[model samples]
Target chain A: MEESSLLPPVVLVHRPPALDFIDEHLSRHSFTALYTHTSLEDSLQDFLSSHAASVRAVVSLGRLPIPAEFISNLPSLEIVVCASVGFDHVDLDECRRRGVVITNAGDAYGEDVADLAVGLLISVIRRIAAVDRYVRSGQWTRLWDYPLGFKLNRKKVGIVGLGSIGSLVAKRLEPFGCIISYNSRNPKPDVPYAYYSNILSLAADNDFLILCCSLTDETHHIVNREVMETLGKNGVIINIGRGGLIDEKEMVKCLVNGVIWGVGLDVFENEPEVPEELFGLENVVLSPHAAGMTAESLNNISEVAIANLKAFFADQPLMFTVQLD
Target chain B: MEESSLLPPVVLVHRPPALDFIDEHLSRHSFTALYTHTSLEDSLQDFLSSHAASVRAVVSLGRLPIPAEFISNLPSLEIVVCASVGFDHVDLDECRRRGVVITNAGDAYGEDVADLAVGLLISVIRRIAAVDRYVRSGQWTRLWDYPLGFKLNRKKVGIVGLGSIGSLVAKRLEPFGCIISYNSRNPKPDVPYAYYSNILSLAADNDFLILCCSLTDETHHIVNREVMETLGKNGVIINIGRGGLIDEKEMVKCLVNGVIWGVGLDVFENEPEVPEELFGLENVVLSPHAAGMTAESLNNISEVAIANLKAFFADQPLMFTVQLD
Candidate 1:
């Protein structure tokens, strides 16, 4: 830690332990970057209580839950800087009533997430990962021919949430001759692709449905039994969104029964606790909720997070303020 | 086999035992598809000797080698219909000397191969296969974050061939925001992509070098030690073309020494027998020379092969005729 005397007024928060690369940036802004959680000698409660009045800003990394109790402890807390794109774990409603400003890592991990979405889709469709496992495990025999995999060309693709990541997903699939239509919160009139207000209709029409939307009450378990049935037996779904976007149980049933052809999932409802059934499935490709966590993307988002923090300390309008009600 | 009395004066040569689907395609054209090799007793020698004069066209399926001796025995052989795209196994020089016309399944497998090329590239770059294996093997822990992968966006990609497959690879990568370049045999002035006449120079300048060029005398072992070294430590190579296009021994060495980052190969030099060393590699993704062997592509190519045979019997202009020098 740098000498506090040389730095500006302190900011309090928990930092991602792997984020020493951003330490220089934090110090550059001359803010004493105090950790509320990681200090060996201090408890989070003790650390927060001692620094309560002085800490006007707090930076939270990943989806580490920011409790309302913690929010109430810091009376002078004006802004909560989220060091990730998704803020599902952060108590938005509590922060809203507390009048705490919220800023997110915006457009930082967009390209990386979109890239993974596409790669996962292609990997599942072509059985790249499955066949790779086959080859690696010595199952690939000299004379034994590989089973055929579906092609991506001209397959109808329906993207849910045409935001920054979703829009890029649509853009990337365009060149592969995939017929692109989307289901967004609202119809983007200026956009060229067809829009579906209802995802059920979208699922029925497309060969593949990709989830890139946020997790909310309206969107939680958005992909249910009815929607999976509509998607039909040969259909596929790719999720780069939060796990709650789809009813994970229904999806599992759908997959087991061959209700849908296959799925390429980066996020699961109960992540790191993926259903054991999926481990044995050939058609499914599983990733450990890492779509936006590429090395380049981490560096990019870290810069964004630090920049937003610096902006907050400078008394400037935050870079990517979330509209919380 | 269908009754020889009913169909067009016999389409000769062996069929792959697994290709029951092609039987319908051949029967649709009412061609007596004779099987020399798949049959129990009749040898290729005995079968061709007895039917040589009558057989004006021979259907060569898969990569079954057509020896010069066999072509010489088929004294009246006017055309050789190759069911696969690459005709390296066929004695093309002998066919040229014998005034035997050659036709291939042109552009039929182009989209499929190009799709695999992109899919393999993503699988290797994003560590999709490795991660999938990890997830499947129950290695992904909630606390243990997956390692970050390399980003494909804005990376320079040098394609070795700008033919149907190469052009499609370039087209697909464009939307991923990849900067495209080429190293085809000739400078395709019609192409907007920057061309490098020297492949070594292309390898040095680009992050990726994709091989989709023909396997000819000039191109065989074209991607040798010097080129791999030039591509450097972080360089990646994707092969959807023939395995022989690269010096496999050198490639294995480069990968072992970390002279190159990784490789995604759908074709291997010795084929079905991939380097046993590559089996243990986490950095390499291998497919058994099945890049163009998708279900849809097989149906498309079989139609082409059958059509070419029908065209020969009907005295029509040959489709996808290969110019044998």
Candidate 2:
């Protein structure tokens, strides 16, 4: 951790200013940066043979999956930072065995993603989209009756996890006059919201239950048939968190059977290929996992990722290290 | 006015529960209540021949338009409360010449309609409808590549004619971090918004120009070609006021030529049959003149209308009187 030992070569395997802002900040400290937009096989071969003597750190933007063999081949790789919140693609167990420091860009897109979550909630509850289509299709004139939709006011909103994004969602919904309740690992006293001791109770009581918890081994498929049954027919589910948290097959069944009123999903299990069954369902709203894809969030993520890279090169305490015990 | 002169027999038309709510407060009044839901022809004929002796005032709900002939025929009708805002359908000139006092149910649906106005603005700017359609249509496989639509935050909102509905719109938009400026007959010191002396100046400076001004002889077609041209291409126009205030031909032209980015129209000229030309345009959002059509607004309108009716018989001061010069 000496000052002289801190300066080392780094390789970034992403393109279009992916961690370029981080490179500029670290360049002042005499650290050499080798930028390459290569595929996984090419990046692994290049890093292993060409830059093996000088490379001290590897930063992946989570676009290319780094295999265990690739990580083990880098003898000089002391620190690895993924410029993403989720590190599922990274072989974290191998990194831990090698005694390599690992960090992530957590809490970067919280506000932007939370804003979209509330927007989707409002859009669903108010039927804003249906009304828009009705007006646009020119069928509005022939319609004898307009669809009656309810306002978000006075609705009970439940948050599955009282984490960063969930807290932000609750704060945004506050001004809309919705009563918010949350379930977390442990209750935080700072937030002025009701807390349920268990998830089932929270789902049972709330009109809308939003999934904002992480997708860990313990939390995968948490929203299964039991959860949907507890949610009842009047309930709506909005998922902005990891897709694996909900059982997609059960969700589809519940949606078809009217076990739940509606759903707004931003993520899905085995994404980029949502089920064909979801097509043309009036009660379901879908997004292509871009809840955190706003311009503001892109800037925020880039800035935060840069900060994590800088701290890693400085040999100081990393900002957001993913602790894989 | 003496107490004896103020007390008059009142004819109540359109007896909804809202009228009964008012009657519950004024049941002990000495003035005779003549209930009539007869056809307009029958009511006019009955008033002219028989009921004219007892009918000292006519409290109406604007369901049946009162002809100028009927206003001239009533000898004992001293006051006519229209029981709704927009006295356009009432023969105000005839009533004024005959010295019949006129009142309306103004400011009743202000907050409710304003809520809807802001909702429409958010829905259009955020492209809620387009996203909704994409999801429901099963086209949501990957994240959207489109740029995030404009947010309400840090936008300059210009409210035309800061009357009741306009003021409410300003109040609601305040929470979204918008800078509100308004144009009205005269500026009021009580409001926090800056006053724009002219509509053209307001349109030029604002990102969103909302039409909430009343439709009058002087205000008709106020948001015309000149004002719209001043609004420029990046601006958005939201019309929640009367449709005649906007020049429809000019609006359609502006929308087609890209003189404005988008428009959210709740009221349109010759509504219930929107122009077919507006259907294919992506920039224009339309509603069936239902800005004041929420369940809450409907109840408020009915209650206010009934209150005006009850007050006329109770010798109480009726709310929202029209100024007939």
The DockQ value obtained for model 1 is 0.59
Candidate 2 per-residue lDDT over residues B68-171, each given as its tens digit: 87676667777876645667666888988888887776766565467567767765666555555555556653323333556565789999988777877787
Give the alpha carbon lDDT tens digit for every residue of A1-325 in model 1. Answer: 2453345766775655554445666777667778754763667778788878778778777566688888898887888878788776677888989898988888888888899999999888888887887777676654446667887888999999998889999999998889999997889868999999999999989999999999989999889999999999989999999899989988899999999999999998876788999999989999888787777776776687777777776667678899996
Best by TM-score: 1
Best-matching candidate per lDDT:
1
Give the range of the ten consecutive residues with the poorest summed lDDT in model 2 chain B.
Answer: B16-25
Candidates' chain A TM-scores? 0.90, 0.84
10 residues in a row with least lDDT, candidate 1 chain B: B1-10
- All predictions: root-mean-square deviation over Cα? 3.4, 7.1
Clashes of each: 1, 0
TM-score of 2: 0.71
Candidate 2 lDDT tens digits, A1-325? 4663744556544433332445554456545666644444465476467766666777765345667876777777877777667777778889889988777777766755775676677556555555666766666652225654555656899999988789877876775567999988789888889998788889888899999999989789988898889989978899999889999999999989999878888788987568777776666667766665544455556566567666766656778888989
lDDT of each: 0.83, 0.71
